[model samples]
Target chain A: MAGHNESGKKKSSEAANDLQTFSAENLQNNMKVIYYSQTFLSIVGGVIAGILGFKGLAGFILYFLIMAISSVGLIAKAKFSVHSYFDCWNRIIFDGFFGGLMSFVLFWTFAYDIVHIF
Target chain B: MAEDLVLDTAIRDWVLIPLSVVMVLIGVLRYFVSKLMRSYQVPDAKIVKEGQVIVRARNLRSGANFIPPKAFRARRVYFSNEENGLLFVPKGQAQNAQAQMFSDPNMAMDMMKKNLSMIIPQTLTFAWVNFFFSGFVAAKIPFPLTQRFRSMLQNGIDLSTVDVSYVSSRSWYFLNLFGLRGLFSLILGEENAMDDTQRMMQMSGFGFDPTKSLSAEKDSLDIIQHEWALPKFEQRAEAVLRKLVS
Candidate 1:
């Protein structure tokens, strides 16, 4: 009975040690790592979109929209599992969707507004 | 052919563009009632997902590059039951997530409802975000070709074949396709809350942790004794970044 009790105490102490080790610092760092990777991807996305001829305001807007989608996507991943990261390829595709839709609508809306204004 | 091309351009300038204007106008008209046009409230987070596996599918269109067709159902497992009511488990991995919904009547049913009441959002995040994206995707596609392309690219996933091993299978899961995360409330219970949780969940999905819980005794140790941990973790983060982007 003495031996069993010693073993139990040893195990419980070890377990407590382990649990305490995972403090808020660790969780924050984990979150920070995710935050940085997303920033990296967003920077890369802007350069690529700009280089591809979606330049100036349109390019910037395109980048913003892509970054928005990417950030949102990454946010979703982080919020869901605290594990997943940005879907690089999915973000690219959705950027096209978001960019295309926004460009098309912005162009559409501007035309109508101009006609009425002028 | 040139005349038709001119007509097309002219119509886009006049008809299509202005029609899109009307769409937004109507979108605003129904904005208060419609989740599609409104910004949803991000729930005060409870249990963040630890890890998830997302399977994405795209169509092999005959012309032009592929488009996203479907993202196979996303399944996320919670790290602990302590997270149940406080953390919003996605609907994708576990449906409804009401412990009472479990087939086993022996499970604590009433307490489960109490938990659901205190925590889980009136609307799930992923479904809420999809409203705007889906409407945008829908309004833009005029051709049957693009429509078919969208459909073929979006929902063509076979979720059953995937291997999703996570802590407690009861955590929520989401099925995202073509900017639409499948509606859980309508399929499970709440119909109006879709827009609220949809986008929030979509944003959170990127940050999920794949590792299950790790209990390390040294976490509690004094910093002087554990100064070695930070660099080691930094190294691990690099490895994880490589694997994540790869």
Candidate 2:
């Protein structure tokens, strides 16, 4: 009985020392990192749009369509974990979609005018 | 309105390429400088202990309901004891002492250092772009904007004829500052603080200082009412056990 109590105490202490893993805090941070990567790629897309001289609605439509395809590719790359993709849908999908729009316009202008305009 | 406005090829070679290069280079430079400016001060042991005590009290308040009431009372008694309860610090004395500790002069020094590092590079780059790349309208945005945005987007050029969608070199620089968060994180790893977009949010908090975070946590913890959670817990447990057995 004494041995069992000692082992139990040891286990409780170990649990105390261990930090919370897979908590809400960690999930939020992972989403932020994913958002960061998405924003980066979206700017690259803008640059590409500029280089290719795509304009107005045509470029805008193509940009999102490409982002959708890339998002699917990302899902596949995550070993088909569809749940992870939807975990932070607000940040990963909607925010990334809109937030990327500004930078896309910025770079798209620079690239398009530089390549095609003057 | 996909108007085929003719642009000279020379504008691309001179203005667009240089703007892109300068923006990327400045971003890289700012990343390294900010990293170098970051200060790591070891927090006082007493402060750490105080914070941990509150956390323990919090855990007990929430989760002790799972244990028997006797065990819960014992833990509560240990924390709420008159002589040395974890939460029983003399309120006025503790607050005064913490106010002193939180007002450490090193905090101001650290803030000054951080501001200098962030500002100096940014100002220098802004000046450089203004001097070298100010005259040219670098690119036209794919979408339209309001006339009001012309002042912002078309900074250097003073032309009513230029479409509101066209952006000058100066506006492009500002756009790149917020936009390249991805590129920096990709090159330097996700943990890097190179991008200013996040920092911009932090700065807009205005007068909120970093040193007050400890005291703020304490203040938040102090306000929590810790009614014990273990009363009638055994009855609930027994009902569950009986249900499972049946």
Candidate 3:
């Protein structure tokens, strides 16, 4: 019974050490890094989709695939310790997913029309 | 898919390319214009101090568990004490801030400048697109859309038979207007004033009531039940070290 109580205390103590405090500057810098990378990746994806004559659902699926790859790259960049740099997993995985969508669509349509249609 | 329109390549050269190019140029131009027009108003010292006090109080509240109970109590009292606390703005002065904000001509001038920088180029761009590329079918999206999007995607072109994927020139301009936000952020940087949506949000959320925020912070600070976590952290650290040694 004492061993169980001791283990419970140890667990609570360990949990205390996991409390995180993030500075505004570091958080903002992390966000900027994500935004910049996502924007660049989305544009590239759009261009590739456009060049390959991707149409309809394929183009959007390609965008999401690119974003997924970007997320993986970000995870690798963070060395798989996303919690050290970000407050939540979503910050790295899904932060700029939709923000980059318009750029992807814009470039996709531009490239598609230029290459295939025109 | 309905029969695809074999659009003139001339429409591509004349309407589509120019409209996009013009929009990009105008976005860059607007960035620089807003940059030039942005008046660096030195924030009032009292406002700055109030902001700092609020931030410090918030930090103290959030980090209270890291500090000793006595220290947390002292800091909380320093901020939220009923008589002479930093956050205790008298009722008279709190009401005066609204009148003061309105009475300040420079604040109004700054607001006008911001509105002008945003409004002028936007109207000009819309007018230019409307006048030049009103009814022309510029380009087709690389994706299918539902019939619900026909009216939106085919604006200015009153064609009933055209595919919803086919974007009219003016509608394409609108697309570029909203879609170029990512490009602008890439080119101009994150906090640029080129985004119309952000500017509209800022315009609507114009008033920053400092007293209200300060009192709210004070109330929040008062309620923080600080249980010091450092003792637990130290025990955890010691246990980890012992495990490493074993």
Best by lDDT: 3
Give each model's whole-structure lDDT.
0.31, 0.64, 0.80
- Each model's TM-score? 0.23, 0.71, 0.91
DockQ of every model listed?
0.04, 0.27, 0.47
Which residue segments of model 3 deviate by more than 4 Å? A1-14, B193-207, B239-246
- Please state the error at residue B191 of candidate 2 in Å: 3.6
Which pairs of residues collide in model 3?
none
| Candidate 3 vs. true structure, TM-score | 0.91
Tell me the TM-score that candidate 2 gets on chain A alone.
Answer: 0.69
Clashing pairs for model 2 are A117-B7
DockQ (0 to 1) for model 3 = 0.47
Q: On a 0 to 1 TM-score scale, where does candidate 1 land against the true structure? A: 0.23
Comparing 2 and 3 by TM-score, which wins? 3
- Scored by TM against the true chain B, the candidates give 0.21, 0.71, 0.92
